[model samples]
Target: MLVAQSSDVSTDLGVYLPLVVMFVVAAAFAVGSALLGPLVGPSRYNRAKLSAYECGIEPSPQPVVGGGRVPVAYYLTAMLFILFDIEMVFLYPFAVSADVLGLFGLVEIFLFIATVGFAYAYVWRRGGLDWN
Candidate 1:
């Protein structure tokens, strides 16, 4: 049993080694691009290039003085979509293995759908489904 456990650990580590290497390479590439951009990029500095413009019109020279707040409804809608999408992703795998999982799987899937439905109802009641 001890020997088998050690072998499993070693095998798992081998399986994960490629994943670690891929992550390291991706990180290195991103960091290299960020670092090398300014170093190798253009050295010109001009007002036209640096100034912020909107729709080809120069913005107001005078800065506006006002408090600003973002709408939470947009974020709530996005989060709800992501939550439901992930639930569907889990459902597909369970469906493929339904025969093997049998009665236990059916009960679990029903419970999952019920929970998601409750959340959907709550969001609907809170007006997340409304597009103002």
Candidate 2:
């Protein structure tokens, strides 16, 4: 017959008391600032502050117009850049662990690239690359 011996393992709740106290203090300070700001801060509004003034000179009385709508091409170009950039980001970690990941990693990466390649082809066919 073989006998196995086990050592005693006990966790002390007092070890975590300091962390709990710090969290409570931080939360109280944050809540106090949020509640105090509106009551103590400025409540009055003045015309001078409300109207736009150009450096020490009186502002010209002109109608303010909203900024023009952004071009769809700009958004499309940005999205394309972000999408390809993210693909490269995923490629890095896989490359670093390639030996350990082996054939499974290779197959998964090939599938990922094929999917992204299809998306790239779709973007190309839709005239997303044209700058005009």
Best by lDDT: 1
In model 2, the number of clashes is 0
User: 1-132 in candidate 1: lDDT tens per residue?
Assistant: 436688788988999999999999999999999999999999999988888866555577776577234578878889989999998998999989999999999999999999999999998998889999
lDDT value, candidate 2, whole model = 0.87
Error of 2 at 65 (Å): 2.4
Local error of candidate 2 at residue 36 (angstroms) = 34
Model 2 residue 46 distance off true place after TM-score fit, in angstroms:
32
lDDT (Cα, 0-100) at 24 in candidate 1 = 100
**Worst 10-residue lDDT window, candidate 2:** 3-12
lDDT of 2 by residue, 1-132 (tens): 955434322245566889999999999999999999999999898997798765565666664476335678989999999999999999999989999999999999999999999999999999999998
Candidate 1, residue 108: Cα displacement in angstroms equals 0.9
TM-score of each: 0.52, 0.52
